[model samples]
Target: MTTTAHAPLLETSRALITSLQEPGGAYPASPTFSAYRGYCWFRDGAFIADGVSSAGEVASPSAFLDWCAGVVEAHRTPIERVVAAAAGGAPVPQEQMLPTRFTMAGTPGADEWWDFQLDGYGTWLWAAAQHAARHGLDVTRWQPAAGLTVDYLLSSWDRPCYDWWEEHAEQVHVSTLGCIVAGLRAAADSGLVTGTRAEAARAGAEAAMAVIHERGVAGGHLTKWLGTDAVDASLAALIGPLGVIESESELAAATIAAIEDQLCTDDGVYRFRADTFYGGGRWPLLSCFLGLAHARAGNTARAGELLDWAAGTATTDGLLPEQVDGQLLAHEYRTEWIDRWGPVATPLLWSHAMVLRLAAELKEDA
Candidate 1:
């Protein structure tokens, strides 16, 4: 993230950020990186918030923050509109939830979000708080916009929309719940999710943690979901909040250790064995997430090593790919036909954004 070393990262990210935009402030469900394009989604918006916050924090001139504010604002009216329509009995057609997953009451189901996903609102709430805390409190801009996000998350916290994986099944999900936990803490710091909001967050987080206790092991690692002892790369969500992992906490250490053992490939981390249904593979974003976690946990040497690995994986044009080859060859599974961008070797916004955030953190702490 040094100015000169990351010039290509900056240029590439600026463009990707631009490409993610939709007219109404929401991002495309996914960039036409695959078959889908142009649908505004809750989950995508949540992850998008992570990247947009990074751009706002590190990308100079800071136009992206304004763009970021718009992203959340776009969802407010649309979501309410869908809910209102659903209540009126003339629900929006499910087909209308383009791109991917999402649902507002009786509205058409989400494009990609066929199932519930509670974390999208949580992620958005946390993202807004991050912008205010790291940068100046842009009350004029972020407060009003983020306020709505806080409200949305509060309303949705207790009621499960969907887990992060979008598995319609009702099993409690640690990743989504973790975000809700972190998001609640973040929003409360700003007094956004307080009173009833605070109570709901506490109740929800407690339930989720109880689920984690039942599902996750104390060996410093966590089971991907409750009741199944499987591991997943998605837990990278845990590392983003702050210095969470401590040497003394066996469960936390086990969780990180489990990630290294189960998910971390030479190239990067992956969700889990079951995630292949979505064509999941070794993910480039997971590498940076691990790196960020390492950095937060005070393992600078390890963090830097992983950071170098992540940087090296960037496409020639500097975009992060959705996943990397297990062989670490850069082109193992990358078929032009498989991707919508058609062999456009690119970095995922999540990977680059985490990198940028970590770099910023390193500098500030240094």
Candidate 2:
């Protein structure tokens, strides 16, 4: 049960995330990667904050949450407008919505990128509530921003934007819906919303869960999209920390089994089959996710093994790459991405965060 072997690596991961965190409390996707440089994603930062929170570090995530509050507040007027328009049967253009990522200074990036994803906003709500509850902090501090986020989701939750991979903008991804459900449920339970707002949040969560059950499931497992039978590793989060699917549920079990049988490799897990980004190598973060789901489901031995594989993917300096280049499904396309984006992202904050998270789970269980 001893986790002493991981002590140094875990500490190193913690230090890496802390060191790379921006002065404005944003965790950059990576310090110097060509593709993700200078960007702070709500989805990535939420998971990163959760990892730091689990390690019992409060200030970093608190600052990040405060930054999140500011970002949400800045977009409040637009979000309200969007909601009003939606209610009037005039939905705003997807491009007019708040972006998935922002600069470290808390403004939307001017550069062209995939900006329509709603999952990040939902993820921030969930992560912020989790941090507040875990630390016994006041949720009211971020309530206004959380309200804005909830309203935005309520207006646009049904719209298909982008998946976690930033592809398939035309499909209603199960992972995206799962994130909204988790966030709304967390906000509803945070004691920050009341009366109509609380009722709406709860009702929204129920409706979203209904959609997931009705259309997001296939072959007894959660599908990548509404009509597709494919599985994405991100779906694992739904059964773990996301709680969109109960860890002990039959559906959760089937999803995990499918991921293992199809996407898992010797090094780690791929984002999905046919992933060509960075040659579709095994992702350290997704491995941590599957491990986390296993840990939550009481399969500690399997979780530990996955965690060990993730830890092994780290460089000698203890920095984890976004993915390792083994078991690549698209080796032919590797050179194209490398030529375009330089090397694959090294020390990706999300990867390190997942490693820290899985390590903490093992230590706590031990």
- Top candidate (lDDT): 2
Tens-digit lDDT string for candidate 1 (302-325): 766666677677777677665665
Give all candidate RMSDs, comma-separated.
Answer: 5.8, 1.4
Worst 10 residues of 1 by lDDT: 97-106
Which model scores highest in TM-score?
2
The TM-score values for the models, in the order shown, are 0.73, 0.98
Question: What lDDT does each candidate get?
Answer: 0.55, 0.89
The TM-score between candidate 1 and the true structure equals 0.73
Error of 1 at 295 (Å): 0.7
Q: In candidate 2, how many Å is residue 364 off?
A: 5.5
lDDT of 2 by residue, 299-318 (tens): 98899889889889888898
The C-alpha local distance difference test score for the whole of candidate 2 amounts to 0.89
